[model samples]
Target: MIRDSYDVIVVGGGPGGAVSAWFAARGGASVLLLEKDRDIGIPVRCAEAIGQGGLQGILEPDPHFIAHEINSLRFIAPDGTRIDIQQTDEVGYMLNRRIFDQELGRKAASAGAQIITHAYVSGLIKNSDSIRGVKVRFPAAEKEIRAKIVIGADGVESRVGRWAGLRTFYAPKDLESCYQVVLGGITVDKNLISLYFGNEVAPGGYAWVFPKGDDIANVGIGVSAAMIDGINAKKHLDQFIERHFPKASILACVSGGVPSAKPFKKIHGSGIMLVGDAAAHASPLTGGGISNAIAAGRLAGEIAAKCIADGSWNEKDLSVYTRMWDKRWGDNQRRLYRLKETVFKLSDDVFNKAAAVLVSIPTEERSIKKIIATTLKNNPKILLELARTFF
Candidate 1:
């Protein structure tokens, strides 16, 4: 009971938490942001490739946070056939996530939010059925801070929403177990991002190579957790690398999970709201989250501040956050998720046929969905089967 209260309390000082704190402070609310980690963004867990279109006007990325600019994509099928898609100037970036997270937290602080690291939130502080604040603990201390609104921007393992009784569980098929390795001594096109797709390559998901420079890159795979049956992801990744770039030197390795399901319908309840990965806002097709994280965070922060200003923290008031998120990104994600379902069900012949069609297309007309749909058109039965199963 330190007795320090704020207008809004944001848990987890990642991109979402920091952005929400920034917007909440900008909205004139006193805000507190807490991070369990000693630093705002350490222990990198992402593939770190963001689309240029995804990161348009929210905030211009600082130079310190951008590792490289990508201008094209190279899609490699299971048999090693490749389809190169030219990137629009408005698309693709390789980010330095640690610096990115720190800058976002700093921005939030500049907007008047108080930030504390190594301050793990242990539970929610509730007044009857409404979340009043959070109970937090640090290395040598513990306290409870009351607030008008509590935001759960904590990642996939979020406890804030769980404590507040929001359902955040993901079925095994809906979560991707990801492993990435930054490697040097590998020659990759500095202007091209690479993706590998095949059930054997990455069951239920895909593999990627995002070039950091001409000779270094981030190589990784996202596979369904449900598909991990005695085949360790790290082993598969190592084998792939050894087969493709045997002479490359490994720089670093990281592992984490990405949620690919539609966000929980009840991300906001009572006086609490969930955003970012906690709300499962990562895009389904790419498992790319930075853009959606910032989007959802800003929305939640704005809605929370408004609710506080109006002195109403009821579910109905908080529903604005849900509506805003749906209007902004929910439909796109749902459609992508459905598409992913069809993709994961595709067989080797189906994938090869799709690749053949992509190879047949003029370079200027090659696109992701187009290649797959065109190949399926040659076999209407297969297209109908996919559509029936998906739609």
Candidate 2:
């Protein structure tokens, strides 16, 4: 590991940190990105579905990292009714995160960011309440690497954000305890993703079958921490799989927590900035973060670089990140959180009714907007919120 001071230091080698390091280094800042794990994206924690629009500026959709291109989705209701939404314009990707995250790290490295895996960052180096750098432990040695700006992209259980006195706590209602398995020899529509709903399937969350290929898929479940009792996410997932794909082979398994709360009020403080799950940047309703993480990473990195060049790296100097992010996505996130609060609590009967209504619509005219329109006929109280959110 390179032991020295730097202009920017990013904790975590996930997409957020890698993208941040890429931009910061490309901007001519000496950047160091550290990952505690042996690899960048091992033990994948997500459903690995990302919208195509999110990749426009950052990277192209290369086959190397894209497992499957998704153009349609099926929403399976409690009564086994399926509402299929086929989109010609809205394309998504089922990513092989192992390669995708490594590609992000390579981009950071190629842009002149120094990266070292198995480098565990224990805490921050602080002076008079101003962030200075990080204290990291390598496989063989412990060292303190100082930097002008330190970004915390260390994920849901973020000690760096805590160390920096940032708001990183999520109430039980906001956290999703998730479990997933890569199943092989499973038959699925190669071009379509499926979402299964109902209390028996996922309680307060949902179950998904994201096809990686015609015969392979990522099957997962996310259960709301508040709504679940003694039943864990894995047990919920196993039961779902037994009912759905009983003959499938489980090739891999992973479980992790996804924070779906609002972003931290203070994403940046003094010389510190938190991105990715550290800031709770994932979608509250869907728990999707790749797009937002990339967006946040790029913004934070560019801002950090500009601020560093201007010789101003305080909390106020970085407040521009907050404003820009809020302008772009804050209101949408708030609206989604409200929708999730209402939707996830809905009983199986409501989901069944909604699914029946949605299925009745012509498949060619079906979309999320149609779902909202249907909801208006059922629940007039949330019409305003739904309209403001989707339309």
Quantify all predictions' global Cα lDDT against the true fold.
Answer: 0.85, 0.89
Candidate 2, residue 304: Cα displacement in angstroms equals 0.8
Considering summed lDDT, which 10 consecutive residues are worst modelled in model 2?
A: 382-391
Best by lDDT: 2
List pairs with backbone clashes in candidate 1: 52-92
Best by TM-score: 2
Model 2: residues >4 Å from true position, as ranges?
Answer: 378-391
lDDT for 267 in candidate 2 is 82
Off by over 4 Å in 1: 1-3, 369-373
Deviation (Å) of 277 in candidate 1: 0.6
Q: What lDDT score is found at residue 68 in candidate 2?
A: 73
The CA root-mean-square deviation of candidate 1, after full C-alpha superposition on the true structure, stands at 1.8
Q: What is the TM-score (0 to 1) of candidate 1?
A: 0.95
Candidate 1 residue-pair clash tally? 1
